[model samples]
Structures are given as structure tokens and as C-alpha cells.
Target chain A: MPSSKKAKSVRAATLSDVGREAGVSAMAASAVLNGARTSSRISPETRERIEEAALRLQYRPNAAARALANRRMDTIGVATVFESRELNPYFLEVFNGILETAALHEQNTTVFDWQRGAAKLPGWCDGRIDGLILIAPTLTSEAAKVLPGHTPFVAIHANVELPNVVNIETDEERGAYEVVRFLISQGHKRILHVSGVAGLVGSDRRLRGYKRALASAHIGLDNALIIPAGFCSDDGYRAMRSWLQQHAGELLPHAVFCVSDGVATGCLEALSEVGLRVPDDISVAGFDDTLSARTTLPQLTTVRQPLRAMGNRAVEVLLDRIHRQNTGDKQLTEKSIVFPVALVTRASVGAPPAIKRVVPSRR
Target chain B: MPSSKKAKSVRAATLSDVGREAGVSAMAASAVLNGARTSSRISPETRERIEEAALRLQYRPNAAARALANRRMDTIGVATVFESRELNPYFLEVFNGILETAALHEQNTTVFDWQRGAAKLPGWCDGRIDGLILIAPTLTSEAAKVLPGHTPFVAIHANVELPNVVNIETDEERGAYEVVRFLISQGHKRILHVSGVAGLVGSDRRLRGYKRALASAHIGLDNALIIPAGFCSDDGYRAMRSWLQQHAGELLPHAVFCVSDGVATGCLEALSEVGLRVPDDISVAGFDDTLSARTTLPQLTTVRQPLRAMGNRAVEVLLDRIHRQNTGDKQLTEKSIVFPVALVTRASVGAPPAIKRVVPSRR
Candidate 1:
């Protein structure tokens, strides 16, 4: 039979061709060449011979051909909403970690916009990716079932638990409590908590943490102080601005804790607009020490979630599941992986002002 | 022969199956079902028959299978450096636009981390993506030659001109001149320009514009006022801080013009650290009206580059080139497309301070 090398057009070297060159069985070449789990049993000398043969043949791994063999595409899909307002500093930090780890493992990362919701997820699973990682997914249990069961999946900050999918999350409620507790320790009274959207777990969890901290400190929860704002800088600005406009002559809170860094950034802008100085007239704190946390003037005092580490672990867990499924050992014992959060004290927070200043009527 | 419906497992319907169901040749089905360029010549009745057959069979286009027919992957690879430091706000705005346009055209967008540079680009072109988009690539002309000639490419803010690739760029020099001229119009004679890296085209062009504006205004350029700094926020902060420390008690410039929004953000922090206030003590301006521009306390007065529009156009042009290349028409008449730049006047800039303030010693 004619060798593939002598074909009319030059073609990529196959496992069979590598085996033919190395004087071994096609299975032996597959183990060493594709890094299959069985490759460990192959002798070091044989592995070296296969590797040398592949190099001499200039063999490049064909993504398509490998999919035919093990049905593994060696690509991971990242699903997130990519709207203008939603693409916050949090996504950038997490994605940086995802791309870093994926590259380290010689895997490709492709992103899918989940704007159309969970219904469109199964369609994206049609052979393009080995697994998918949903970022801060807000899907119901019923909606989560739309994800195909055959593919391994992972979620970071997922609002709901999906069967068989590992969820990587931070101790956000604890983080909020710790930060607020720190604010209380700084002698702050009448603290204002600018909450996120009412229904979201991300929002409510922080709100819960705020109430718990206030109760532990023996301070009554001021229902008026808990302003329900949406996420993003614009939302925070609008919420704070409207509140200030309504109570122009009322005493300002000693400190304000915003739900996210983006919100905190907006609050700072609004405060600055109203001629209030951060940490001097009133201290400010934020959760999720994202880029926005550090970029603002006087830098925000925020809760540090190890977002990059979480992203790296998500890829590692998903890859382990993929490999286990490939080897016919597919049980995932750990359904939840939570990382601890810490307080990042920056220039944003300070001792409460000596005098309670009234909210000025104009800038 | 039995129809495909009798198959044991449900399979995606192919053009041949559609043809059989519609009682027509496979070529007719290819034209109608595949929507090939030739499909326009088919009669309305035949198209309707093919559509009905496809609906009955539940035909869905398989990405891999379609690539086999047209040698087109229907996917575009976006090559950029994804790192904690490199993942600037500039990329987020540009990427949003790319995703939006790609979704509209039904094209899949996959990201390739180009941290390894041009050496890894050819390896990525192995039958996976139809074309590639380079975002803010700093490839040398020699390095650009390594790109595979067969694949189409579109570049946004590419540092060097490639032989056949279409390059999308903004007029940074003009933006710089207009902004500096505006600063002069605001009664600022002594202006400090904190620039990006010295060798980069982006840096040099803006420098040239600054000098041109100074010369046109008959104001002699002060070599001491042009401080060389990198682009990121930290670079800007350190540069400004070091300069202020070295020039303690010296007369401060009436205005500070930063090379990018990130740099301006840092300058704001450094200025705030001292006793200086924006537009009151020293008017500050920035280039590249990115998210950092708006997120600042006093919104930045900078240049608008239309980054999203550039990203959208990059996908469009690359797709056009890919289709033309598939049809054997690969002439690229235009090598570079320059987008106009505009100045955004905001609260950052104001008239020069009434009296020159000395650089304060410390925070």
C-alpha cells in the first residue's frame, strides 16, 4: 500500500503513520502522541521513539481528527452575558484567569454570549467544546436542566445549583459581614447599605450579611438606609443621587457599604458631586475588589474574593471531570467548592467624622 | 432503498437527504438548503420545496460538516494578549462590539491569546477558523510576514502595516493636536504631557501632535514638561508621583495631559494624594476615552476613537475577504482604513489656575 506521505497533496501525519515510522502498533502511538491516560504504561524508550518520529514527520495534532477518536474537542466554552452594561470589571478578572489556565493546559477557550438564556445553551454544546463554564449564571433549576447531561459543566457564582455540576463560589455573605463589621469597629453609626437588585442571590446574600453585622453590633436596621439599587455604576449613582435629593437636609450616614466595586465607584462620584469627601465627611466601603475598586481616587476598601484562583480551579475541576468521563470513572464527589474572602483595607475607609454633616442641597 | 428515517439513531439531515425528500437532485438541495451563493438562481417553487423538506427532516447546519463543504469554518479567531495587566478597559469595549457584530452575522468568535506572538499564529490557522482579527497587535513588519498568506486578516490598532491585511486605525495624532490646542484655548501656557512608551507609534504620534499644537500656538516647547511614562494606571501614578517628589516646591504646570485614560486615572490619584484638585489647581486631560475616562470623579476630557465601531468593522471586512477568497477573488486594494477621532469636553479641563501653585511635599 502507498504511504500517506506520497499522496498527491501533502497531508498531516496520522497516528498510524507515526506508528509505522516508529515500528510500533497504532495503539502505542495513540497513547504517547495524544497523551491518553494509558500512555503511562508505555516504556520511556518507546515514548521517546514515538515523540521523535512525530517531530520528524512534523505531525500537528488535528483538532477534528482527535474529536473523532475520543469525542473530546480540547476546547472549553465560557458562557456569559456580554452586554455593554453587564461586562463589568469582574468578568475581566475571571476571564484573565480562565485564559491563563486554559493555555497552561494546552486547551482553547471559546466564549458564548448567554444573552438568549439557557434555552440556547444545548445548541452551543453541539461538538464545539468538551465542557462549558457559566459565569455568574442566573438560571432557574428548570432552566439549568436545559444544559446537556453528556458534557461536563462547571459554574462560578451560579445563582442556582445544577445536578452533577460543580459550583465554585466565594464566601460572599461572610465577606460582606466582615467588611461591615470592620466598618462598625471603626466607630461608624447609621451605616448605609446600598444593596443590589432585590431578587438576585448575589444581591440578597450581601444584604443578609449587612443585616447580620448590624444586629451583632446591636444596631437597629434602618429600613430607609437599605436602598435597593441595581448593579453597575450608573445604577448606584442614580440610587444615591435620588436618595440625597429627597433628603437634602438630613444627616448623612457615617459610612456607606455598596454591593459591588462598580456601585461603590458610582457612590464616590455622587458623593464628590454633592461636595462630600470620602473618609473625611463619610467613609465608603465596597465588595468584590475588582479593578474598579483600586482605580478610583482614594481606592475603595473592599472584600477580596480570589476571583482568579477560582477561575483557575473551575477549569481544573472541569478538566478532571472530562478526563474521568473519558476513562469511565465519572463520579464528582464535591458538588461545591467555596473559597474564603478577605478584607482589603485601602484608602477609601477612615474613622467616622467628628461631626454629623447634613446633606447639602447643591454642589 | 429505505429512506433515512429508518435509521436506528436520529441523525442530522444532510443535503442529500433533503434532495431525496424533495424529489430533486442533491445539487438543487445544496443551492436551496445550504443557501450557497448559487442559490439565488433557483426558482421560488424549488426553494419552497427544499425548505419544506428541510423543516420535515429537522435539518440543522453542523459547523464541522459545513467546513468540509466550503472549507469555511464560519468562525473568526480574535488574537489578543489576555493578562491581568494587559486586560485593559480598551479591550472590553472593543470585544463587546466584535461579539455583537459576529452574533448578528451568525459567526462564531473564538479568542486566541497572542502572548506567544506571531510564532504561534500559523499553528492556530490549522483548519479551525476561517479568518483572524488582531487587536492592538504590536507586530514588527518582519514578524507580520509570518502570518499565513492563505487566511484573511483584519487588524485594529496594529502597530505595523502588513502586506495584504486590512488595518483599522484611529487618528491619534489629530486627536492629540486638537486636545492640546483646546488646552491652549483654555488659557494654559505651561502644559505637561505624560506620554506612553517612547518607541510605540501611539506614543510618538501623540507627542508629535502636542509639539505641533504648541508650535502653532507660538508657544515654545518645554522639554522638561514632557515626562515619559508607560500606559497603565500604575505607570501614570508612579511617574507623576516621582516627578512631583523631585520637583517639590517648584512651580507646577497649569495643566497635565496624559497619553491614555488609564494614565489620566493614575494622575488623578497622584494629584489627589497631594493637595491638588482637578480643574481647580491643575486642568488634566487624557487620550482614549475608555471606561476609565467616565469612571473617574471628574469625567475625563479626552479623544474618542470609536473603538466599538472599529471592532465591528474589523469583523465585517474580514468576513468579506474570507468570502471573496473562497470564490478565488483575493485582491485587497486597500491596505489601511483610518477612522476619525473627536474631542470630548468634560469636567476634567478648565481655565488655567489664577496663580501658579508649588508642588506640595507629601500627602
Candidate 2:
């Protein structure tokens, strides 16, 4: 076999090929074809000849060569951690927004898998991408300190504050507070809270909101009613199931407020397994009105975070930062951009049952 | 303000900087640092000096310069079409597998939004990616003929055959036949098929499987029972709702076999709206056991297509082709790779209701 990859087909036309066809040097051809600043010095007749040759040869500029000349790859990097070995619905919604805005700006989006606490982040600062958007990164202060200073970064729901990084966040505390208030308005005195991973900023904010809502309604906080669960469906399921088993025959809460939609799905399953119905035997509410919220049997009455809009804003903010960096502007304008959250009332939330329900014993 | 972007921080060390620090030419440093063939020409003392300077400066090679030197980008392109302005669960499962395999191979993955019938595909062959993976492309023959021959291509569930493209597919016909057979075994006589878009290979194969299963069971085909629906949830919801409205006061089918899990979720929602309980009022089955299958209220009894495994296989096959292409071997091997499918029994499918159910009139 010949040592040529394009032996069987025609190869793409390059600047040299176009230059030869136009009877000019490769530098002159590149100047005219790429619309470089030096092209203005070329005569109109010579420029027209170069342009005609390029069109005839179907010449397309190589991305690598163009990037070398302009120092812009026109690509944005998205670094995210997949939960439970899969990209959850929350990430999907946000990514859709990011992809949409990035495409509109004619920038290619490349994805990088981010392992928490991994120091491989600095390795991604090579010149392949112009900027990066971090999705819900939970970096320690030490890891945050080592972030490459040359590259501009924008984060969505960053767990810790990083120097010179803009964090896009939602008003989760208010969302949790409003949802709990809505449950209270439905005449639910005792509400169980399924909190997210302990000590995280998001989890702590939601916990504060839950306590504040109960106190405002004159319903004392029952520490026993607070169940610690992670952000996944399995966590919610295991927590609910084990709680029921340990407190068998104990009085059940009037409503269960899950930290996320995924966790709420698991809570629903655990409840159904013991022959209990949602919003009937006990009301259930979930944060983050993801697609699963509507797919449930009775549909979930949950708090809606504008995840898609926040994703779009992350790209916009990152682009602004990149532009400022390119223009040598080191001023930090906004540290955080917060979006509002709303409560969506659906079939999952109804008036408490006429009869008080007790936790069913494990079959 | 200064015009220099890196005035506030130390700039990343370049090959020239390393060479200057090591008292060697830039070309000598490049060969030693990039491990090029010419590195053996340098003496041991010079190589050691270059290595020490590189370590001291914390040098990282630029991706663009590496690609230019090797004529390989070490990046794979994933082109996919988003349905209903969002990526469905099916794409998510496959993408996760691709990302896992690609990362393991030290390749970056860039995503491009492909619009159906658009001629923008040929433009992507500008040497930015070593190979391209098309996810369920529905291209016309004319469009297929125009695919650039210089680049290697791998497609998953491509609608039409493209010359020199390796297609990764699943046994959809078998999957569909077994699910319908399972429904029949549960005592379902009148089964409704919610087919995907008309004329697509996947939808047609599934339709064939549904027909063959009915024929083997000696059941006559009912044209009215087969409702045409797209792959998205909204399509399935509208199709089911309209079918129910048109058949008001008529006997309902014993079960519904939707083309995809997303469609199944929609079917469940439409049934719930009209006060029909899944597996109790009527049975429902979905295909492509995606994440949504388990998240639904009763869960979903669907066909598992091993989407993740197929995605992993796609990357492997594409990498092999890329290697062969680089080595100047144009020989074609393995035109198609088929993966097996299985039926997953969940909470959705059950025996038909005891009483004859009739479609209720719309309120």
C-alpha cells in the first residue's frame, strides 16, 4: 500500500494548491483567502485571481491554521460531573440551553468529564478551547486555588467561591421556603424534609428555608422528621424505606418535601411499595421540576428552577469574561448572578387526608 | 490599561522558552519534549537539560501545535439532532457510553448540532476532528452521496445507507416481536402499536415485528389500532389523546406498545388524564429501556437495546477505522455491527382488565 491516506480520493485544497493555481505565492494566497490585514496591500486584480482560484478549487480554511493565525479556536468547553454514572435530567436541561446559545454564537461545544477533587482541570487549559463553563462544580478551596489563571471560567451553582469566577445560581432558599409555605397553606402541620447531601451550600440553604417556613407557620421543627438523603433517586428510596422500617407504626408526616426531583421519584416508589398513594395517604413535593416531576402518576407539585435559562446565562457570562480577558480588562464586574425560582402546583399536592395516616409496616 | 492579556500572571512556558532556558534550539526542545523521531539525534546531556527546564517551567504542549505536527486532532466529533428542542433519554444513555470510552482513550469529544437534510455536514470535514459519529441521522440519498470521503464515518441507527460508513444497529425487529409476544402472553388480544415517524428504518422494522408477532399468534391485523406517532413524548401524548377521542364509546385496546420509552411516558400521562390506570385499566409497554422507563409512576415494561454498549462499540470501531485510514489501508471491513435486545419486565405490563373497558367521552 502507498504511504498516502488520500491515495483513493481527492484531498481538500490547501493554500499552497490555491496559490499555485492562481500563479502566486502561498503567503499572498493566504492573505487574500483569509482576509488578513495584509490583503489590503495586494492589487485588486491579484486578489480577484486568488479568490477565483480558491472558489474553483473548493478551498476551505483549516481550523488549526486559522487558530494559529487568530489565536481563537472558537470552541467552548463544558466540564460537568455525571451523577450515578449518568447525566441526569437537570444537567440535560441546562446543557440544552448552553448548547443553544453557544451554537447561536457559532462556537463549538466540547464536553469534559470532571471527577470531583481531580487536579486534571489545569491540563484542559491548553489552547484547544477559548473559554470554559463549569456546571455545578464542587471544588475544595485548595483545588480552586490551582485553577489556571490564564483561562477565564464561569461556573453554574459552584459549591465554593473561587477567585475571579462568576457563579450562576438560583434562589433555592426562596424556592424551598415558598414550596414549604404552600404545603403549610394546604393545612399540613407535620412535613417531612428529604435534604440533599449534608454540608453542601445548596443543601444548607434549603434546610434553612425549611426551618424558617415551619417557624413562620408556628409549626415547631421536629428534628426526627428530617431525613438526610443524597441528590440521587436511590438515596431518596433507601432513606424513605429505612425510615419507614425504623419508625413502623409511627405517625407519618402530612407531606414529604424532597430536595430534588430525582430523590422525589425514589420517595414515591418507596411509598407505593408499602401500598401507600401520593397526595392521598401523604402529600409529596420535590425541588427542581425536572422531566420526572411531570411523568409521575399524580404528577409532582414542585419548585421550578430556571435551569435552562441559567445555563444560557452561564455561556453569555463566560463569553463576556473571555472578551474582557482578550481586551486586557481584569476588573471583576459581577461575582454571582441569581435567578428566581417558582412553585408549580400540580396533582401531587392536595388537602391532607381526612384520617391521620401511620407509617405502614414492612410486608 | 496595557494591551497584554497576561500582564497580571505568568504566561505558560512555550517550547521556545524551554529551549532558551536549556541553551538549545527550539527545534531540539520540540523533538525532546514531544518525543518525536528526531529526539534520538540529540545527546543525552542536551535531552536532560531540556527535560529539567520543561519540569521547572511546568510546560504543557499546545493542542493546536501537536495536531499540526502529527496531522491528527485526537478528537472525535459527535453530530446529533435534538428532538423537541431537548435531548431525549435515549441520546443521553448512548452519549454517556461514548464519553466514557472516548475519555478512556484520551480523546476529546465535541458535539455539533445536525439539522436534518442540511448540507452543513460537508463543511465539518475541515480537519478539526479525526473521525465523526452520527447519532441516528435521517439523511436523504443525495445528502449521503455528498459525504466527504476523506474522513472516516460511523453512524448509529442511520436512516439511509451511506457509502463507506459503518452503521451500528440493534435488533429492533426482534425486540419489538418479543415485547408484543409478552403482551400476548399476558392475555392481550387487541394490541395498539404507536409507531415512530413513517418510512424510517427503525419504525418500519418495529412495525414489521409487531405484524409478524400478530401473524404467528393467528390474530388478524387491525389498521385502526396502529397509531402513527413520532419518537418524542409530546408526539405520543397527542397521538394517544386524539385516538382516544376518535374512538370514544368504543372498546379500548388491551395494551399499547409504544415505539420508545419517552412515548410510553406520554401514553401513561394521557391515560392518567382520562382516569385510566396502567396495568390495571390498560397495559402499556415501551421500547429502548431508557432512564425514563424506571422513573415513571408504574415504571415501564420495555425493551432494552443495550444503547450504552452500542455507543462504546461505535467509538471502538471508529478508532479502528481512523487507525487504518492513517496507515493508508482503504480496505473495508465490517459494514454493520448488530447488538441484541431483550425484554425487561417492570410494573407497566400486566394481564388485561377483567371487564371490557370503553374509551370515555372527553369532558
Against the native chain B, each candidate's TM-score is: 0.90, 0.92
lDDT of 2 by residue, A65-163 (tens): 777666778789999886564458878888888888898887878898786554778888888888899998988888899988888999999999999
Instruction: For candidate 1, give the docking quality class from DockQ.
Output: acceptable
Clashing pairs in 1: none
Best by lDDT: 2
lDDT tens digits, residue span B175-235, model 2: 9999999999999989999999989999999999999999989999999999999888888
* Structure candidate 2, residue pairs in collision: none
- Model 1: residues with Cα > 4 Å off, grouped in runs: A1-59, A84-86, A327-330, B1-61, B84-86
Worst-scoring 10-residue span by lDDT in model 2 chain A: A1-10
Model 2: number of clashes? Answer: 0
- List residue ranges in candidate 2 displaced over 4 A: A1-9, A23-32, A36-49, B1-9, B23-28, B36-49
